[model samples]
Target: MSLLAHGNSILEVEVTNISTHGVWLFAHGEELFMSYDDFPWFREVAVKSIVNVEEQSPDHFYWPDLDVDLTREIIKHPERFPLKSKSR
Candidate 1:
């Protein structure tokens, strides 16, 4: 007999860890880190909000609770997009 596949295998992005300094994301078998210095939006958000991530598309992630959207490129090279939103 063949093994069954996952119900939602395409859902590949997730928040694996959160610390005082940053959050860790796991996507497509690779782990990416986002520091508070680069991703300040997540620094002060609640854990629930932070983990509530959705993969809007390939390489794109969204946090509905925080109303934040990010792509793999942005996370990998934050310097390329320097104008961040001012703190609320």
Candidate 2:
């Protein structure tokens, strides 16, 4: 029998590393890379602001400090969706 849910344990989404090129996020047993080329809002941001990320849902993430909300799909395949808002 297959249980409809995972074991009762909390999963945390966090920024594991940050570099001039991008940031590494650890979530749900996977490590994801988000580059400044696609995620320009993160460029030049403080470490405190960059690390302040929240997982609103299993596939949705929000950075309250940056006022940004992104989905796993968007983060993984940024090239599929072009036309970013002009960075100031």
Candidate 3:
């Protein structure tokens, strides 16, 4: 037997993995990595907070628990946007 998906369509964005080095995000059929060195906002957060992610729009993600927002481009190319704030 096979289970069928039901209800409204789910957003295709999520935190796939969190490692000692960084976090991995899967969005819109693409896997993106955000190193702690670059994206420090997630470095010291709780696991529960990190997993609570939402896709506000195409390629845009928001973490209500952490109040952090990011896009696919930012995750893929941190060097392009070089303004870092100390992670609390």
Candidate 4:
């Protein structure tokens, strides 16, 4: 089924696989693995947390449940953005 058919924006996060760690999403052409280590919100979430995943375009993914969104470019190239607070 298509991700757009899921209805919920956050629930649209496609669930490829579920394990004790977290869920895997297949967005665009790359496979994004969201682990609880980085995303603590999903650490204890049930399997139903991820409703569906829709491809807004060729590089964007919409999650209707948690209102979490991401882009393919960012997942593929996270190093481009430094991990530092903007206050500095």
RMSD of 3: 4.3
Weakest 10 consecutive residues of candidate 1 by summed lDDT: 1-10
RMSD of 1: 4.8
Which digits, one per residue and each the tens of the lDDT, describe model 1 over residues 1-88? 0112576444467788998889999988899999999988998778989888888878989889889999999999999999797654
lDDT of each: 0.85, 0.82, 0.85, 0.57
TM-scores vs. true structure, each candidate: 0.86, 0.83, 0.87, 0.58
Which is superior by lDDT, 1 or 2?
1
Better of 1 and 4 by TM-score: 1
Model 1 has an lDDT value of 0.85
lDDT of 4 by residue, 1-88 (tens): 1633457543333568878876678654556876655445455545565645556766686656555566766555546643522220
Model 2, 1-88: lDDT tens per residue? 0112366545478889999899988887888999988988888888999888888878788889889888889999999989675553
Each prediction's Cα RMSD? Answer: 4.8, 5.8, 4.3, 6.2
- Off by more than 4 A, model 1: 1-11
